[model samples]
Target: MSHRMERVNQLIREELSRIMQREIRDPRLEFLSINAVETAADLGFAKVFVSHLVTSENKKEILQTLTGAAGYFRGELGKVLTLRHVPELAFYWDDSIERGARLNRLIEEANRDSVNPSGE
Candidate 1:
């Protein structure tokens, strides 16, 4: 990615976070976090990666809510962003944080086994 694209991605992420915090009133979005934003080279669309502290049971519902609100988010972006065109937002559930925690648990278990060696 070029420097300009990086800047654009960062700007979009920040603006989206702000919008979510101040504008969105959905209870499902209370603990949501915008993990990252990846915009296409032509600025036509963006893939927004997001996560929440809520249970996995609510993951599908949360994603659905975010996807349904994409248009509103884009409209809000248009009002704040100076870009020639506001990219279409696509919401995706990001599991990187969960994956990292799982990986850490595995590593710790491996270390414990290494020390014990014989299941004592």
Candidate 2:
């Protein structure tokens, strides 16, 4: 991506994060954070990755809620941005944080087993 593309991606991420925090009042979205945004080269489409402080159980519902809210989000984003065309938004759940936590726990368990070797 060129410098312009990178800047556009960052702008979309920041603006989306702000919209979720302030504009939306849904409880399901309260814990959501826009983790990153990937805009296409032509800037006609974007993938918005989101992370939540909430638990895994709520993930699906949160995504559905965001998906339903995409149009509204894009409209607000378009109004705020100076771009001639606002990219279509696609929301995706970013599970990297949760996956990392699970990996850490597994590593710790493995180390503990190596040290003990038997139930004590």
Candidate 3:
């Protein structure tokens, strides 16, 4: 990605985070975090990667809520952003953090097994 695109992504992420924290009142989004944003080259669409402390079961519900509120978010973004067109918002659950934790646990388990080959 070009430097301009990177800046755009960072700007969108920061603005979205601020909007979610101060404007949105949904209980399911209380602990939400905007991990990253990837905007299309033409600025017509954006993929918003988000994460939350809620249970995995609530992921679907959270996404639904966000999808439902996309328009509102876009409108808010328009108010704050100077872009010619505010890209459509698409929310996605970011599980990289969870995956990292699981990988760490597996690595530790492997190390433990290697240290005790005979299964003490």
Candidate 4:
């Protein structure tokens, strides 16, 4: 995790977010959020973590859709960045936000139970 790699990852994340907002027309990607980006030091491959506020019932399908659009993202990257070698894009579902929300709900439930032990 050198400084250069970190900068590259951040640039990728920002560009992906911009592409999703201004370029993509897919309905399935309307709510998608580019959570994070991780690229190899050699700039050969990248993993883009995507998250959404919507339900995860069809999470697989959503990721598959994004994977299908990887080529488009890569092309856009090539147009935007001046790097000699652009990383291959790979989409992954990031469940961190969902997990954090669930954890918060559980904590709230525990607090409620503690305050109302009588269960009225």
Candidate 5:
């Protein structure tokens, strides 16, 4: 990312954090963290990635809820952060945490197999 894009992404993250905490009345928005933001080169759109601390059960419903509130979130972002263009905001669930957990489990299983090669 360019320096300007990085700066803008940081500002968006901060402003969204504030909005999520103070402005959003939706209970579905709770227990979530704004993980990252990707702004298009033309600044016409932004993809907001979020991570939820809650269980993966019903993860699809959670993502649906967040996406449904995209317009409200974009409005909040525009209100809090003054920018030439507040790009259309899109929400996505960041799966990095889940990927990391899966990788760790695989590594652990490999290590255990190496330690006890013979079948018990």
Candidate 6:
């Protein structure tokens, strides 16, 4: 992506985060945060990745809520952004945190094994 697209992606992420924190009243989308945004090269679409602070049980419920509010979200984006065209927004769960946690556990295990040269 060009510098302009990168900046726009960041702006979209920030604005979406702010909107979730402030304006979105859907109970299902509660405890959600914008994790990342990827805008298409043509700037016609944006993939908005969100993380749910809620437990795994509620994650699906929250995603359903977000999907239901997609239209409203796009409208909100249009209102909040000054762009001539607001890209179509697609919400998705970001599992990067879970992957990071798994990687951390593996690293810790490796470090422990390294410290104990002989398995006792």
| TM-score winner | 1
Prediction RMSDs, each to the true structure? 0.9, 1.5, 1.0, 1.2, 1.7, 1.7
From the highest TM-score down, the ranking of the candidates is: 1, 3, 4, 2, 6, 5
TM of each candidate vs. truth: 0.96, 0.90, 0.95, 0.92, 0.87, 0.88
lDDT of each: 0.93, 0.89, 0.93, 0.90, 0.85, 0.84
The deviation in Å at residue 3 for candidate 4 is 1.9
**Per-residue lDDT of model 3, residues 1-120, tens digit only:** 999999999999999999999988889999898999999999999999999976666999999999999999999999989999999999999999899989999999999999998889
Question: Which structure is stronger by TM-score: 1 or 3?
Answer: 1
Provide the global lDDT of candidate 4 against the true structure. 0.90
Ten contiguous residues with the weakest lDDT in model 5: 53-62
- Clashing residue pairs in candidate 1 (N, C-alpha, C atoms within 3 angstroms): none
> What is the C-alpha lDDT profile of model 2 across 1-120, one tens digit per residue?
799999999999998888888778898888787888999998899999988887768888888998898899899989999999999998888989999999999999999999999955
Candidate number with the higher TM-score (2 or 3): 3
Residue-level lDDT of model 6, residues 6-99, one tens digit each, is 8989999888888888887777777787888899988798898988776556777777788787788788888878888889888888988878
* lDDT against true structure, model 3: 0.93
Error in Å for residue 74 of model 5: 1.4
Winner of 1 and 6 under TM-score: 1
Residues 8-68, candidate 1, lDDT per residue (tens digit)?
Answer: 9999999999999998899889989999999999999999999997755698898899899
Q: How far off is residue 9 in model 1, in Å? A: 0.6
User: Candidate 4: where is the Cα deviation over 4 Å?
Assistant: none
Candidate 5 segments exceeding 4 Å error: none
What is the TM-score (0 to 1) of candidate 5? 0.87
